[model samples]
Structure formats: C-alpha cells, structure tokens
Target: MPNKPSLTTPPANDPSLDNLGHPAIPFPSSANPPVQTEPVVEKTAEIMQPASEKLTALRAQAGSKLRSETDQAIRKLGAHSEKLYVSQAKLLDNCHSQLRKQPMIFLGLAVATAVAVSVLLHRQMR
Candidate 1:
C-alpha cells in the first residue's frame, strides 16, 4: 500500500513552513519600513510657498494694470464730455441767434408743435 501525505504536514521544500509544519508568520521587513511623512509634508510646503508668492505678485500686477486702464477710460470720457459740452454750447448760441432774427417764425413753429402734441395725447386717451 502507498503512503498518502496528511493535510497537517507541509512539503519539505516550502520555506514558509515552520519545523512544526505550520505556516510561518511573516514579520515586517526593517529595510523597507513604512515611510515617515514629515519630510514629504515639509517638501510640499516648500514647493507651495514660491507658488503663493508668485500668485500675490501676479495679483498686484493685474490690479495696477486694471487701475491704469480705468484711469485712461475716465480721461477719455472726460475729454468726450468736454467736447460734447462745447458743441452743445455752440449749438445753443446758434439757436439763440436764429430765434432773435426770426421771432415770428419760432412762435409759429412752437404753436404747431403744441397742437401736434395735444392731438397725439387726445388720440392716446381715446
């Protein structure tokens, strides 16, 4: 009769088996221990510091540029408004001269405008 190996006995060539034929419990290796995270945290902070400073500098530059552009726009608006004021004053002076030269014609035009507005308002109410 042939001999059959029992389940409790490990093969002789298995290094993971103890002298008692039980599986050997493996201990953590000292050469490859869990990494200490302090260095990584410090390195991350060091990298981010330069980025934060750059962001602040960029924000300052953007703010200065925006302020300069806004000042230019305000100056342009002021110049345009001055030009419009001068043109309007000239137009008013011309109108005044024309009215003084032809008082009767201006009075007739004013009466006609009033009559047209009254007729429009009366139709709107109806």
Candidate 2:
C-alpha cells in the first residue's frame, strides 16, 4: 500500500464547484424529530379559504335579486295609482253630463205649479 491517510484531516478539496465560487447545498437530515402539528391543519386552511370566497359571492347575488324584486313592486304600485285617478275623474264627468242633459225637465215642472196657483185664486174671487 502507498500509505494510509490520517483520519484527523478532511479531503484535500471538494469535488464540485460553481463559477460563482459557492458550495452546493448538502442533503437534508432524515433522522430529525417529528413535527408537533398534524398535517390536517394546513390542509384545512387551504380548503376553508376557497369556501369563504364562494359564500361571499353567493351573498352578493342574493342581494342583487332582492333589489330587483323591490324595484318591480314599486313600479306596479305606481301603475295602480294612475289607474285610480283616471277612474275618479270619469265618475265625476258622468255626473256633470247627467245634470246638463235634464235642464228642460226641471223648468217645465216649475211653470206648471205656478199656473195652477193663479187659476185657483181667480175662481175664489168670483
């Protein structure tokens, strides 16, 4: 044998080197202590985030639907109010026409009563 090397010293130099002059990363330790937390905690947070976002979207949709329904109801009420006004005006107009058409009937009744009273007074004087 050529000669056995001393155990105290490391190898003469590393085999791999980069142009930037930094050493590569070494392998991670496999025999480290177990993590304190369960893996489910991280997974639950990932699952919950998307669900909350979807819930907010649904709430916005419902609010918009409610507003649309309320607007329609208001429009219907306004249409009914206009209809009521037109009906009242028609009723008043009909009453006025009836009074104008019967003016001659009223005058004839008044003249007949006055003539009857005059004749009765002349007979009594005789």
Candidate 3:
C-alpha cells in the first residue's frame, strides 16, 4: 500500500485559505466599494434638529422653574427659622422673669428635684 495525504490535513499554499487554514469568505474588494454615508447622516441630523432644539428649550425652562421654586422654599424656611428664634427668646425671657420674681421658690424646687433624681439613681443602682 502507498502512503496517501490524509483528508484532515489541508492543502498548503491554498489561495482561498486564511492564515489559520479556514476558507475565507469573499469580501468587498477594489471591484465593489462601499457607498457614501455622509448624505444619509446629514438627512438624519436634519430630521432630529427640531426635536433637539425643543428638548434644549424645555431643559432651560425646567431649570429656571426649579431655581425659582427652590428660592421660594428657602425663603419660607428662613421665615420659619426667624419666627422660631423669636418665640424661643420670648420663652426664655418669661422664664427668667418668673425666676427673678420668686428666687426662694425656684431654689427650693431645684434642690427638691436634685434630691429626687439622686434617690431614683440610687434605687436603679441596686
């Protein structure tokens, strides 16, 4: 029997074979070139221009509205903070006047409160 070439081994120097020995699919070569794409791109841009402009205008309007609403909310919070400070100051002044009017009563109440707290603490420690 004579030694024959195996079917598993591809033929060497085959023009149709790629570097890895697989058959290469035919691609567009110098004979058939790709079509120009610039006109298609320009048409698409023209179609989208109106929507793009509307989107930009909407964005600017929304930003301005948001800033105005934020400023209104900040002003409201500032007013509330000022009112709270005034109320708190008035409460402190009232308490001071009451303490000064009856110093003996306030001193007695403070001592009694301290004694009660100490007794409660001593009980919890046990």
lDDT of 3 by residue, 1-126 (tens): 999987785676675653343346444447646667999999999999999999999999999999999999999999999999999999999999999999999999999999999999999999
What TM-score does structure 1 among the candidates reach?
0.64
lDDT of 1 at 41: 97
Q: Give the per-residue lDDT digits (tens) of candidate 2, residues 16-56.
A: 42223434643323653445566778888888999989999
Writing each residue's lDDT as its tens digit, candidate 1 over 41-107 gives 9999999999999999999999999999999999999999999999999999999999999999999
TM-score per candidate, chains pooled: 0.64, 0.43, 0.73
Candidate 3 collision pairs: none
RMSD, candidate 3, Å: 5.8
Candidate 1 regions exceeding 4 Å error are: 1-40, 124-126
Better of 1 and 2 by TM-score: 1
Q: How high is the CA lDDT of each candidate model?
A: 0.88, 0.78, 0.88
| lDDT of candidate 2 at residue 108, scale 0 to 100 | 86
